[model samples]
Target chain A: MKNIDILVDNATCLRGDNLIFDNISFNLSNGEILFIMGPNGCGKTTLIRSLCGIQHLENGCIKINNVNINNPECNFLENLVYIGHNDSLSENLTTYENLEYLNKFDLSNKDEFISNPNKFLKFFDISKYKNYLVSELSQGNKKKVALSRLLFTNKKIWVLDEPLSFLDEDSKNNLIKLFLDHITNGGLIVTSTHIDFSNYFEKSKYLNMKGININE
Target chain B: MNISKIANLKYFYKHTKNVSKILSFITFSLFIVGIFWGLYIAPKDYLQGDSYRIIYVHVPAAWLSLQVYIVMAVTGFIALVWKIKIMEIISIQSASIGAYFTLIALVTGMIWGKPTWGTYWVWDARLTSELILLFLYIGIIVIYSSFTDKRQGAKIAALLAIVGLINIPIIHYSVEWWNTLHQGPTVTKFEKPSAHITMLMPLLYMLLVFNLYFVTVLIKRVRLGIFQREKNTKWMENYLND
Candidate 1:
């Protein structure tokens, strides 16, 4: 275990004049799997964004490995992986080129990621579309390519917002299998999704969100 | 005290008060003084007569137009690298201000040239390069505004801004590089200014005033951008209350 931990203390968030959530607290450390479940408009997306350092909370503090999220000296992002609602891939670039762009992030064994990646592409069954521009790819194909990046980076904490959105059943099964192995190897996965994980994986912890003071 | 407040739009407004107030006061006062001094006090050009008075507006626009482009590029770079929301917002707003100033510079230069150069428009290097700068600004605006994803738009715009920076040096050195209708450098250089001191002094003040004006405008634009972006947040609604 690499001792990965996230502490969200008294975390309150507001969306416009609407109070999305308030006084929400949670802690997850080392090899933990947390599935944030909520209906639409329940602030699941907002909470995930705040955890990934993209969205700002109104009156709260988040600490990563005991370092305050606001601390300039914090090394949290270096060890974290975040996939938001937006696909960060460029449409003008081919799927391979988009993947190549992510190679700029400093990571060990990146030399092995050179050129077309055969393993992850084959896993997602999108090996045929590697050379196609992301704009040309179907929505499902584009989503798969974006999801493959999670398997590419070796970060400790993965904060994914709607990781299952647009993935086909077979690809979803493959991903769940990969995530199972990842958690077994001491990685932390925090994701928000409406998909039920009860049939496939029973070991996953569920954190239900119902907005501010609406305990589920 | 919160270092991270500068990143998020909602929190950014909370911290905008002090800096915005001070800059607005300074820039407005200087604008009044600089305009008065340039128009009434400065002596007329011996050769061009009172027509050179247009330099008060033309020169400041020329300087700021180019400088604002550079600032836009800088903000774009920060937005791309650090993923700051304010930087992205500033990059978009700066592009328009830069374009506005470039328009003023071009129009004023043509007015000044009509009496002096025998033609209002020419194929001179400085003028052509400045026209290209206008195109670059338009290119940035079009690329950024057209995209469905604002962040994606910002990323592409930033790259373009950085690439467009190569033109700045060309625009500055075009007079020296080619035999152009535009006059060679009169103010910028290690050598003392060739123009009369009284004339140079007001022009200098106008340059300072123009830069301060850019900042004042930037601060106001940034505040508006922050508000609109955070429209979904309760804090923004409460913020409007006070």
Candidate 2:
């Protein structure tokens, strides 16, 4: 697999008077999953948004595959997929339509992907409700649809903010396995989880937000 | 070069930084000059006399009212095709401003009609279509703000705007198609204008002025909308901090 490098340098994020994180730097390469462990309200989501280039940095920059993300046209978005705290799925759309719409921007193998949105749905155990409107689905199923977006996106950098929060244990384990399989196939994953992922990832690094000063 | 490449180049150049603000300022200034020339410098008509001066305001308002809808429809197309948020913002703001001008035109037309046509209002083709144009604008804005999910709302609104575009041409050509109290074309390719150069120049100037005023106000409204929608975004934070 070719080396894929994601670097965030000297980043500072602020929400109101509270400084979420400052002077933060990190690097993730191919086949590595970096686990960001932080307490509630510690800017983990803010960090994820900044890395995705949806949120701007107060102090620094994020480089994806050696391209500066600030330009917006640097093709960085094509390489990265972000699933934020809110499930960005359209409630009025059926699960099938949601997946199809999300995959519209992707130039990947379309036939292969479309033929088996059911495959991921089955893996996530939401196959029975595959045709259900997203609004009618349970919270966990909605999250499943949001996560399913990642599978169809076929991007290298996956930035998932709290992917396991709304899932049951079995679904959580299934997701972790999916993450592991993604990393095994040479894709990079950066996830923020309050729950411990120590058992799933052998070399996962943790960032504790409790120790960081919020006022600075 | 292929049409697609030429279009892509046009799109790229259109979105090039610093273009919107410059166009906005120039259009705004022209609008101001047009308004002054139309409202004051234009010669009074021999028959209609002083009351004909209302045409300066009425014609421009009517033109921009329709023009703004066309702008919204185009921007709506862009928003849906490219998923560009800025396009949606432009669409929403343009609709609001366009609806406002359409209302102004209709009301002023009624006032002018009352004095000249012997009725303050009539269910005439041009006036009725103009009213419908106002409704379409209102419908677009209502659809945009009704939903909690902004993306979904924007998509629906864009679709609504595209569908509502049928009303624009109808409003423009209504006076010609039907024999009504509303006068026919002052300016059209197929027919010679009834207006003399002395009166027509000011009417044209007012048209220009109204367009500039729309551009200025639309820019301000769009910027405000952008700030509101992107309040939580980091770029918005940077803007606020600055």
Candidate 3:
């Protein structure tokens, strides 16, 4: 696998006349995890969105592998896997169907989940709900279906927001293991959460949005 | 020019504020003149008489209904291709305005048809295609509103708008394509208009009025959309304070 490097330089975001965050900067390479910690409404989601090229920055730019995301020639999205606060799944579609639709965006041959979705669904403990409509599933199960995309997608970078909120303890543990395994294979993950992950990954980097501080 | 520069909501909001006022003034003036000329000053139609004055309203509305859909389709294309937020907002905002124009065209056509054709309704090619156009607009509006994620809704709606564009040419050429109770051509023809100069003049004037009126209303609606979508942005706060 090739190296993955992300650069967020002097980022600033504003809401109305309010300054959400200012002069934030960070860098990450393959196998490193970026944990954005913040209180509610502290611009954690905004920062995550900006990094994923879903939101524009007022002053700075985010680059993946030295190419600025705003550049039209940049094919950043092809290598990106994003799961926002919303699961972004169709409620009317079954769990398996939703995964099938999302997998079409995966350019690489990551068909292990596509061929046998039960592998990832069982890992998340949602295999029984595979044929059920997404609307019938609980919030955690919906989230699990969304998270299962990570296992099937060959994209190197995963940007997630509040991914642990609706998951139970066992699901969360399973997800953390998946995260660890992904980084071990040179994949990079950027996540926003209020929970402390020090107990899970001691080497994980932290960016606290409350004070625009970076703790390496 | 960079598309992002032109599509900037802050600049567009302010620019439309100054421009819409002038457009509104011109629209009001033209409506008054067109009404007087078509209803009173213009010589009566030798064949149909004053009942034909409804043409002043019907023709302009019918022309604008198609024009607005074209605008919606173009904006939808830009939104889908370039993914400009302003274009998405413009595409969705045009739906209701275009729908209203289509409804006006249909109702006024019915009122005109009662005296001319001896019936208020027919499933003629021109009329049927127009009704379909209105349904397309309604479909876009409903599909857009159904999604909780507004961006996703806009994308799906944009795709529908582009696909629905095929109906425009069908609507435009329907009269030529099929035999129908609808009249063939008027001021839109390539040759000289069949009507006399005085009678034709007001119809043209009313067409201009409708065009300007669409822009006037579109500017207002798009400005409102920008405000609603950017309600929490710094530019909006600055704009509100000013």
Candidate 4:
């Protein structure tokens, strides 16, 4: 099978009576990082959701590996992971239990994460809270737990919405390093963030929501 | 297991917690009174004698059991079509209660049959169909609990319930339709009830009691199911936190 490339062509999304964004397009290849930077309410979340096939695109074609992404037969869904703005963790479960439960559905290697869960938890600085109920954790810690799920999955395309919103400075740097490591291993990382990541990714493209322009 | 932790009737109603307890208590109380009146107070049947007393509990139980299934099936349909989380929860709750009542009816019928027909069990049409209903209830509950995706499980269970409903009418009408050894409809059709007004009064009262009892248990189970499904929701957090 040929490796896939994701292309969003002339996409437009609407929220209520207002047009959130129009004619948004981009192409992402393997071993590349595309940083989506936009101010609040600029439809960065909307664009990511549309690309992940969770939201309806008013007018656009998302093509992956030369096949229409929206086509049910393409099976693009199996190759992508989209973590939304909301923390989808079940609060009743502990961090370890949550990760173990999610790992069952992951298409990636399970043994790596299963054997060294604390390594990832420490990387996110949540090692002490590993056994704590998610309901008891702070918002930033909860976001870290949610992000850990991404590390457990082996999906090629990672679509994240505001992943750095609640992380501390050190945690943010660790996440940037993790993203860089993911792309270095021939995976694609598409994330929406307001924080400046220019020092980390040299070739990352930036999109400004104010004028609706794509930057390189 | 703590009785105090089980949640009392007033507190349960206030918090909408464990509503089934109160309902079950009221229904069971009515059942006790009805049983005493039907078996001991009412005169022995002119033809079947004391054996006819079984009709009071057996017939009502059988009727309510089928009624509960229909209610469950309807809720299942709503859950599947509308994607209503509450409907799915209620459907699951009703399934267990309905199954229990169906089992009670089957057992009581067998007991009454031992002395009258000289057999505790038979492969008669009504009995067989009721057995099938019990299996359908089990199938629904099992399917719902097995899947991780609550919505998907509810949809599948709802479809199964609807399909199983086809057997309900067959269970009810098997005696009249197929000329089976089992008796035809007694309390349902008023044209010719086998018992007089004195016997019928307590039976009707017991049926009403059971109806209220089913509603009470249903409310409690629905509440528990809702708590399980909505535990992750923000609303649940607010409710619990407060």
Highest DockQ: give the candidate number: 3
**lDDT, residue A66, candidate 3:** 98
| Prediction 1 global C-alpha lDDT | 0.79
- Candidate 4 ranges with C-alpha deviation above 4 Å: A1-216, B1-15, B18-25, B170-193, B232-242
Q: Give candidate 2's total backbone clashes.
A: 2
Which residue pairs come into collision in candidate 1?
A: A15-B232, A15-B233, A15-B234, A16-B232, A16-B233, A16-B234, A17-B233, A17-B234
RMSD of 3: 5.9
When 2 and 3 are scored with TM-score, the better candidate is 3
Candidate 3 segments exceeding 4 Å error: A9-25, A39-61, A69-186, A199-202, A209-211, B1-8, B15-18, B83-86, B145-156, B170-193, B229-242
Top-TM-score structure, candidate number: 3
Tens digits of per-residue lDDT for model 3, A1-216: 888789998988755335678889999999889999988988999898898787756567788889999998998888788999999899999999998888877755556666777877788888899899999999989999999888778888999999999899999999999999988888888999878875677568899887777887
lDDT (C-alpha, whole model) for all candidates: 0.79, 0.75, 0.83, 0.77
Candidate 2 lDDT, tens digit per residue, A1-216? Answer: 556898877788655324688877777888888777777877888889888777755467788777778776787777788889898888899988887887886645577667877776777787888789999998988998888776666788889999998899888888888888888888889889888875777656555565542220
lDDT of 2 at B5: 32
Q: What's each prediction's TM-score?
A: 0.61, 0.55, 0.72, 0.50
Which ranking of candidates, highest DockQ first? 3, 1, 2, 4
Put the candidates in TM-score order, highest first: 3, 1, 2, 4
Instruction: Quote model 4's TM-score.
Output: 0.50
TM-score of chain B of 4: 0.78
Pairs of colliding residues, candidate 3: A16-B232, A16-B233, A16-B234
Q: Write the per-residue lDDT of candidate 1 for residues B1-242, one digit (tens) a residue.
A: 22364346666688877889999998888888988898889997767778888989998998898899999999999987776667888988899899999999999988987776767876556566677789999999999889765656777898899888976686557644663334444212213336988999999889989988898888888887777666665677787787
TM-score of predicted model 3?
A: 0.72
